[model samples]
Target chain A: MSIRSLADDGATLVASGLTSLQRAHPDLVAISEEPAYVIRAGATPAKVALVSGGGSGHEPLHTGFVGMGMLDAAVPGAVFASPTAFDISTAIRAAHRDRGALLIVKNYTGDVLNFSIAAELAAEDGIATETVLVDDDVATDLQRVDGAGPSQPDSHRPGRRGTAAVIAVEKICGAAAEAGAGLAEVAALGRDVVHSSGTMALAFRACTHPGDDRPAFDLGDDEIEFGVGIHGERGVEVRPRAQAGELIAALTAPVQEGLGLGRGDAVIAIVNGLGAMTGLELSLAHHELDGYLGARGVTIARTLVGNYVTSLDMRGLSITLVRATDRFVELWDAPVRTPALTW
Target chain B: MSIRSLADDGATLVASGLTSLQRAHPDLVAISEEPAYVIRAGATPAKVALVSGGGSGHEPLHTGFVGMGMLDAAVPGAVFASPTAFDISTAIRAAHRDRGALLIVKNYTGDVLNFSIAAELAAEDGIATETVLVDDDVATDLQRVDGAGPSQPDSHRPGRRGTAAVIAVEKICGAAAEAGAGLAEVAALGRDVVHSSGTMALAFRACTHPGDDRPAFDLGDDEIEFGVGIHGERGVEVRPRAQAGELIAALTAPVQEGLGLGRGDAVIAIVNGLGAMTGLELSLAHHELDGYLGARGVTIARTLVGNYVTSLDMRGLSITLVRATDRFVELWDAPVRTPALTW
Candidate 1:
């Protein structure tokens, strides 16, 4: 089912792209043959080095985020695939100062297993490592049936999938770490950010995998996939497309309830484009969501609307709400220079 | 024909969204009843105030760019429509502070007329105003016949259409102005940036005008429009899509030749998404383009790959090559705190 890519060599293409990015910021970044990259200035400034990675498709996620006040290093795998434990361990060693290292991992089966293994390997090498798992996707909160083979499991919480909220987590933890917080404190701060945030996404169309002709999923002209996953997995519902207000309501209500946000609460509202959504569309969505929240008496203290986290070329969007504390807001506003999210 | 949007009130929605942005950086931005907004920090830091605006559909173009080291004020019209002379005059007055004001305008008939009129009005009010017109689109470099009716005749150069390269112009001029350059000096720098740059765009799909179900143009499932205009105008050619390398070569060759970029020349390669193209696709295009230019021995000194300038929801990419002077590179790397292009 290989479709076509601009380059038949996917890894080489990604490497070259990353090289171009590194060239853009020669003073701040460096790439390595370890199939990893490290943000140079971050190493000496922090007590705990933050390392994060997963697949390469999520550009600007783990990689674009490595900078002065972000992740110290990022180890990228193949598109939609997890990096090897050896590569992760090497990234840890490369980013490690005298202080310990902290791994920020998304909640995926392969990522969890590999990152965990990398932590163990790092520990054996005398580097103390801690991990903060981000599981903020509210869409996957549905119960799973148990003992139904690999196809289905009943009465089990499969755990929330981490989507765009990892960016918020990284920003807060990176700031805390840079401010000289230890590994345990940084990890605790990351956990607090995750617990206060929730995300929901929907896609108008499915994304095509590289070298694959068929889409990862399908939708009719009049239908949209609600609660869509970043990897193009089937959503919880496939419903006829609704108007903007209703759609915004549907997406935001669950997130509000999940975070227990209510009247007079301040929040950071992030309207994230999942790849191909236009800036106009994201802004319009933010407008609608802002109105919805306002009518519900919630105060949006901070807002970010952009394609921060995406699923290849899928035409969709995800909304993330993080309940803001004075500390979280301070960290969020701290300066960090990354390839994608800056200023 | 128009396609449905999330909000029926486009103006209201846009205002709300901008309000949310203002809330995000209350210290740096403010909205006014002047039917325009001004970036507060830029006003006091420089001599000549940089002002720009156009239609609303182009999100983050004029508005998102209003901040430190960029535009001082931005006045937006309705979607794809030019701002009125009155509003433009107001923006000029609001941004003016003993220093003159410079308007950065894209070369479209409506925009040129309106900005020119506003400059005249500002002059009447004892304000010195200058304009830098951007006309870098090579797609519109058609032979114009003299003495023909509005519809026909040839032999006159209609001039190139201005597109994404306006960003380069704004950034350089903004930096020059912020550094306390005189109005003429800033204007001259803008002219230099525009003269040394060119852009070409292609769209995989046409964006619908809001409120219409029909697309602006038609293309077969396997076809794409080459040399597309940002306002959803028909391109010069429509052909079945080729592989990534062939497509990228087609797009980059014209821009390279237009800029007269040769071997050993350093250039900034900007692969901008026209709204809905995914980051992966844009990166793939950049990879192919990097190879194409490398084969020609052109050194890509810096690379910016993102949806910076867009035609809303149009699934396309535009390649802009700016011949880099040492000054250009310095300004490009200069810190800008805009909602869109911040680094």
Candidate 2:
């Protein structure tokens, strides 16, 4: 079977999506013409500016999130590709106002290299910056080498791949910065969220890239790619199709174990769609996840179920669990007014 | 190719989705166990209560929309099926106060019959009620049938099918009722919204029913079903696939003419995802649509781009346009706190 995308041109897809986003949310965000960055529209009390960006396909990730109580600026690259170092540095300089800026980079090689280079460039431009690298996808934590914690860099291990846990990091750190936290404190808080979080995904059908006629990968009728990444990459292993409850358990177990969650542990859970997954499916998956976690005595303090971080039209979902502290729960409950997530 | 659903059982899909929805938004909605209806939670002043429901697949429609600024109660039936009159009546009694109630019924045979019956049953229980029947789908306005306006129920025709325009009716009417408007006024506003709105859809792929292995129908790779409905039904015609701009124009032109839109007309535009269409695709489609409307001298007063009303996993989107009035814009700008729509 041939697959197709509504946006036929990959080169123009991000531009069109960004323009439409700005048009729909004129009050919340504005687009810079050159190098293409989304900036928070309305002015507010100056604090540590929160900036983030990644590949274009996982929208609402860095763009739809540029608004009050979230990202101050977001730079989007081409589909499934990292933004240029120049784009990131420009956004950081544009958003920072003496309060310094914090860059939330997902732990992809391209994204990390570009964001780190941008930080150095921003420093040369007289702007101080801190980086919070998110590596919450437990799928990449293969082998789990000694001292290979969420923040530790291990050359032998590729380490964790960032997935939906970035939502928790952005939300919590955004709340902290909005509440007047300093740069160091906000970065520290973000790292804390990443440390307590873990995510894993599975896809029965991979996503077709814009302008492509076939999906990135294919699977058998009764099989699924477990522990998949966000860019339509094949998962770590193939598993036979199972019931929704079993699938939920399969994704949730590793995250629960990675976080060392047990009886009386509180968590903020996110049952996120990887594009084609419906709200009905995500909610049902959440029901299964909630039940499983309850049976294990892990209390859910808050929950989010939707297509927040998607991989084009990949037909799958990821579960992210953040072992919650009182501060985390309070920050998560704080008022947010972003285009994709607001309360 | 076979399409699979995350939820394997159609019988329990609605229940699982609702349980998960209530769990996620406990402060916003509560599930009534017996007949499985979702009702708004939290205390509020007595006002005309807004209630609406339909089949389960078009989610975030009646259920995800149940909150402070939308439906007071939402009764979900099985996928692609209507709730019984008993379920609707129970929900009405549970939600209505001394100010009476308003039932927002989408114009489907089963839904109209059930909601009308429930309205009568509520009357027998000594509660005053008014009903607003929404049928804004221009695709179903076939043959015109001599004086078949949106609200007119001609015996000779099936009448226009209700589509995403129900979101406008429920939202505007909900805001009106929340502001203490009487039932008659709320119902009138809903009907007015229906009269001004028009919607059209196209699908490259059909959705599979929960637990089904195959899709509702099949189509060639280069053809699309134009003017499709929310129940995964076939469209009015099969048309050759075109570029994004041309496809957007194909859907928008008719709705523009159907509403008699011309220079200086303002509208509230909704680019609603049927289900599996990605946010990137939807936004890019919106960009083309915005350019098309602007070239025609029509202005978009407000825009909503998301999957508020979906057809499970159909890979398509519907565009809805409601000619804007001062009151409509005011009400549209009114604060709404629903699970699917909040600002």
Candidate 3:
């Protein structure tokens, strides 16, 4: 018997996958490029409608918050591809049927360029469109780390890579929207989150398209890449794989350095799976996380341990630590529901 | 160039694993085989203590729920192996140090036998230990497919397995303990859950131990075993691998027919990973769950889509459906704070 490829968006896979997802979790609604969704505020007519999208793969970041709180509309791109410009603009228009729409764009070239052009076209059509780029990944040099041996922030120090920033932005911005914060507040928080965030990943092997069976590259049974991205992007280092403690240290060095966490400052840790890693493994990584942070005398006030954000089926973990001020912790606790995430 | 093992308690995996589990998720804790957990309820002495344990492999179930509105103590067995009578006895004695204790035991041979012996031992010391067995797998035949379909209960039915029963019992009994339900009520509900519940698993291949690189069994690249156990038991059927939908249908048929899930009845589906299955796979299976339930006319009111209960790095999935009533739904909604699970 031949193995049915798991990487696909054919009606069969989508339909079966949705059923399985729903069966496993009733709260999540697995939307596809089919029968798109649009969001708008109830009761009072809201002043702003926000639209964001890329693909069916990047889940909770875009669609998970498409309730009355976060997004007015989210245009899902094809799996690792971009959504059509028309789809983006149209979805924005639908969500903005009452309020003017704003586009929340990530810093990816394709997403930025496409959403930016779509924003312009939507603006021409009389809808207010503002595009914000979330270049939160320090892995790609998003932030200048403040390095003092995990003791101080240095603008000149090498920075950590980006991790778990989208979660903070979507969650905080979504809460702000629910509390009637203006577009300025939402966009500002989004910007602040990106500035403070960093992520880096290592793909043990590359994932091919749905119909493809063979993996892109093979590693020794005991090999792992470092500083990789979710889309099968090669890592900064392709050293042999080590234990979770070493892996967490490698991932956390940049984060702790970039943020310059000290003994008193509190932080939130997100040990995210790149889709392929098991939740058990995700749970298991927490061991490395607490030990590393505690040994350095860092305080972790709040943590989200699970696959809050996933990159298809990439086999890796990304650590995103946010400096937890009182306000950021409040924002993290604000509850919003979507298919990929919930309170 | 070294491998990690669970045996070395002082090793990095053990040190960080325990630290991470405790720090990030405080609800989870490792009690000495003695099960010494301090509980303070308001100002009054605790009235009843809930104690549960089996093996360490099932994370959130017995251990994660030890924080609040759940178990007061959870003694863990090694990896996929059973805890000794001493561990169970110590946990029970400690929990009963100031109050009576209730032990929620899954219907496994080692667990049942050991917990029973411990209960008897506890009784000798004037501490009462009530044991409830959860045996909910309806997909496998203790004998063969010739066994009863879902219609018959395990005692009468032929193929009874254990998978999703952990969640159902945890939900029901956790709520009962929260509501101050008596030992009788908690035990009764636990038994009811095992009686009403059913589970089946599929494995792509057998899992090797932590230090072993190869699987215990040899399977073709495309082959997967159906009706697999959590400890990598031999599957009842080893046919050519099929689509997730077809596999799900095969898994569900025994339970649906045995339980008689008519087109009009409501149910809850749990698509669990047998350790190594990826979230992408779970999400894809989740897609299939809705369609399958809808086709059978089984209204799925509640679904949990994750690796809530997993086998050790086993690449398989188990589908569990509880015959839903208003009560069961209410139980599921009841809030319980555990290390691995929460509402």
Off by over 4 Å in 1: A1-13, A33-43, A143-157, B1-9, B41-43, B142-151, B154-157
True contacts kept of 3: 0.26
lDDT of 1 by residue, B1-343 (tens): 2333454455665566567567656666776745755455433753798889888777768778888888888888777889899989988888887789989999988899999999999999999988999998887763222322234334554567788898998888988887889988998899999999999998887877666566688777667788888889877776665778899898888889988888899888788888776556677788778889989989888888888788877878899999998999998888887787777
lDDT of 1 by residue, A243-301 (tens): 78799899899899998888889898889888766566787788788889999889887
RMSD of 3: 5.9
iRMS, model 3 (angstroms):
5.1
i-RMS for every candidate (Å) is: 4.2, 1.2, 5.1
lDDT of 3 by residue, B1-343 (tens): 1222222232232223334455565434443412322221223235466777766555445655665556777766666667788777877776663456777777677887888998888888888656767677754554444342255656874334456677777677767766777777777777787777788777775655555656556678667677777776676666675676787777778777777788899987787766555555666666666667789788877777666776654667788888888888888878755655655
List, residue by residue over A242-301, the lDDT tens digit for candidate 3.
666777787788778877886877777777766545444565666566667888888777
Lowest summed lDDT window (length 10), candidate 1 chain A: A143-152
Residues A1-343, model 2: lDDT tens digits = 6775576687677898888988999998989968889998877578999999999888768799988888999999999999999999999988996899999999988999999999999989988899999999987765323333345457755567888999999999999999999999999999999999999999989988877888899788888888889997666777887888888898888889988999999999998998888778888999999999999999999999999899999999999999999999999999999889998
Best by TM-score: 2
Q: Please give the distance, in angstroms, between residue A119's alpha carbon in candidate 1 and its true position after superposition.
A: 1.0
Estimate, for each residue in B1-343, the C-alpha lDDT of model 2 and write its tens digit.
Answer: 5575576787677888889999999999999978889999987569998889999888777899988878899999899899999999999999987899999888899999999999899999998999988898888855323333245456766687899999999899989988989888898899899999999998988888888888898888887888888887667777787789989998998899999999999999999998889888899889999999999999999999999889999999999999999999999999999899998
**How well docked is model 1, in DockQ terms?**
0.43
Worst 10 residues of 2 chain B by lDDT: B143-152
